[model samples]
Target: MPTLESFFAPQDNIALENEAAEQEAHLIAEVEETFMKLIEIREAKFMDMMDAREKKYRALLN
Candidate 1:
């Protein structure tokens, strides 16, 4: 029986390299999307707090 190394020895290494590169690119894109969503959520919360503060100050002034 042929060993695992012998079986893979004749295969094109470039295909494996390309597959790894594609997976890495996909992972990076997912991470970037997640980061951007988190930033947007933070910004929304900050805006909400600012609006609340403005409402409170206006009520106090009135």
Candidate 2:
């Protein structure tokens, strides 16, 4: 005895939407964290390069 109303469960839509929103938020947080890590890596690399360059200049002066 399947009625037309049984084909669609409207009550489940809210839960589904909430779950999707939670997943999206989690993904966004992960992306932000990854981006911060990349920035930190880039900054550290730049600092290392600058230090190396400064040492080279100091060696040339002496």
Q: Per-candidate TM vs. native?
A: 0.80, 0.84
Lowest summed lDDT window (length 10), candidate 1:
4-13
RMSD to truth, every model? 2.7, 3.9
lDDT of 1 at 9: 42
lDDT of 1: 0.89
| Tens-digit lDDT string for candidate 2 (1-62) | 99865676887777777899999999999999999999999999999999999999999999
lDDT of each: 0.89, 0.92
Clashing pairs in 1: none
Off by over 4 Å in 1: 1-11
TM-score leader: 2
lDDT of 2 at 51: 100
Q: Residue 29 in candidate 2 has what lDDT?
A: 100
